[model samples]
Target: MARIAVIGAGTGAMAAAARLAVAGHRVTVYERSGTYGGSLGRYARDGFVFDTGPSLLHLPAVYRDLFVKTGKEPLERCVTLTQVDPASRHLFADGTAVSLPDASRAGVVAALDQALGEGAGTRWAQFLDRAGTAWDRSRRPLLEEPLRDDREVAARDPYPAPRRRRLLRPARQAATLAQIGAWELADPRLAALLDGYALSYGLDPRRAPAAAALLPYMEQTFGSWYVSGGMRELAGALYERCVLRRVEFVFGAEVVRVAEKDGRAAGVELADGTHADADHVVLGAQPGPELVPSQAWDATGTRSAGRAAAPGRFVVMLSLRGAREAGAVHRTVVHCEDGTGEQEAVFGGRIADVPTVTVSRPDDPSTRPDEAHEAVTLTATVAPHGPVDWTDPALRERFADVLTGRAALAVPGLRERILRAEVRTPAETAADTGAAGGSVPAPALAGAGGAFLRPGNRTALPGLYLAGGWSHPGGGPAHAGMSGALVAGLVVEGDGFRGSR
Candidate 1:
């Protein structure tokens, strides 16, 4: 059996650890924090609970497969996974609101038509149909398999943009996500909706490739899910599954370096100056300068391609005294009135005067202190750590106020209902999760000179692989799980392993 040392006890690393253990590998996980979940963090105060990390789970099959492959119990048995009906409620800039039914293309189309204009629903449906082609075309190379050095195959835009013909205007295809939104969706609200999907993941629609349409397609097709408790419960289940598979975990043990021998990864050096030998190493977090001899930043440098900066999140956790009313959508997205300006501000190293906000209010009783109280979390995509100082309390409060005010549109009397409130900035996120400058990792996009393609799982150094949101296939909880699977498949099956079937 090969010995494996995994860095970071995050969901992805733990997922790989569990699978590797099941495959007869002696796996040991080292985490800098006392907890198992990395970005899946939780905050509790006065009997109220909130997930500081991602609030929802999309494409839950990623975890379902992990649970099934590692043990006899299905994912449902380990964690209660429920489809969030009316997947989301959107409050547009024009004050038009629509609640889309979960996993129902017809329902979504109908709802959009009912809320928007006559052809809004049809336009959205057509867009989704085209998006399906992008998903099918790129799913294998971009998501299902390890990234290849020759990105020519993956870099080629797969989004089938319809040819536009006009008098004296050459027929052409839409390349960027912004182009697709403007050319196909037509309606300003619909364009904002499309951009919102991309922006929510820290991607800028202005430059993100048309393949970015896959984000909404995946959600609309697979459906969004929520656990009985906060998303932290899902992380707990992964940790438990790894334990059941006999994987050893050492919490609060920070890995300081990846010791190399004979030009291959040999083991890990911990913060305490101790070392553990292993045949292979899997990095779940972006490695620091000490971990490798390379520069502090990867080949892409510390930031994303172009002048655009990495996006961060500004969160507001509210504890309300009132019980959640019946038939309330679990999630609501309040789109920014100035979508373009907001993107420019955030990416240009300034606070958005008006930022798109996502408000999550899960009805599950576990998050509240009985039915009398409710837990609400508000998230806004913002600029990552850099020239902007998220550490300034006044600045953070102002951003939080803007997001809270925007969320007020979704939840009536939201400001009045709040019994208490707490704020989480990218600065805290960076400190808690080992991500540089609290910059949340975005999903890999398809264009702009392969800007979206992340570093490959297999590094130049032998016996070392990467498995996390920052690696190939990119971010999001589901993608993180896929990274783990790919890493395990590569380690166990060798060079021939394309991916799991």
Candidate 2:
């Protein structure tokens, strides 16, 4: 059996380990953080629990597949499912409003019909139906593949070959989500839906992908659910599965570097300066010095030729006295009637306090005390380098000021209900997790080669591979899980969950 050393205990790393171990490889995982569950992981305050990242659970099957493929059943381990609300209420710049739902695309169309009127409903249906189809089409092939084969991806283009030929660069226009967003012209409604799509990326909808306009279809169409006891439970469950499968997890162990011999990964070096051998090394995140051993950050394929998304974040860990009806509790973005207008203001360098707000309620069993408790996270995209003049004191004051304002606008008396609050800045976020520029999630900007420059799963380094939010198929908790599994399949040379036999 080949041996492998998977770095980082995030979902991607965890999933990769499972697949590698089950494939008969002697796998050892090295986590940079003291705890596991990179993004979806959680921490507790005096009797309160806070999920560090991703609150809602979509694409449950991604988690299910990891266990099943590794000879385990996720359903036997975690919460089966709980659906969240489908209606995502949007308050537009022109006072236009609509709510998109999962059960009935009809409701969404109806709302659009009311807002846009007449033929709008038909267009709405046509859009989501195509979106649903897009989701179905990309699920297995793109999500599961290591993305080493770009030619294969191009073949799946929805536009027929002749139409593609007529368009000189049809692939460029639709190869990846970000490219779609950047290429969009001045169509306001499509822009709003695109903005809604980029919400996953914490990006402005105008620059978001038109293809991404399809993401909402899952929650609104498939129904989102809570994992019951925080999505971190998914991590804990995976850890347990690793134990059951005999996959070794070296926790609280920071890998100092990866070792390579004659161009192949020999193993990894720990912070303690100890060496561990492996037959293969799977590296992820916007290729960093630590990710590629024996190579400079700029020299390795994972690093030099990689495409990194933004890593900016604004977050609060609060103990809710009680969560209000709070919409469907799945995925929500409550707006200030002028929400999209407010978002435009933000991008242009103005804070609307509560132009829009999103909250994730984890199913942590002990999240609430005798009173029902839920975890709420509120964030908006900010300048990645952060406000130039946002001094420590100024930023601190601004954060509190912003939170207070957002709470009032989003939920009545929301500021009053907080039992505790912990705020983090971009620099602080990097300090907590060694993310680049506090870039917990990297920017998915398509490089100058149109869309062709976006890094594939395969890097120039022969023995190394990449995964996580920085890797292709990008972002969201579930996407990370699948990314990890994709690397495992490639490293071990398995047939992969993608492609027909």
Give RMSD to native, each candidate: 1.8, 5.1
Q: By lDDT, who's the top model here? A: 1
lDDT of 2: 0.60
Worst 10 contiguous positions by lDDT, candidate 2? 157-166
Q: What C-alpha lDDT values do all the predictions have?
A: 0.87, 0.60
Candidate 1 lDDT trough over 10 residues, lowest sum: 295-304
TM-score of 1: 0.97
- TM-scores of the candidates are 0.97, 0.80
Candidate 1's displacement at residue 466, Å, is 0.3
lDDT tens string, model 1, 375-486?
A: 9999998888765888898888788888889999988788999999999988888888778778888887665567688877777778888888878878889999999999
TM-score computed on alpha carbons, candidate 2: 0.80
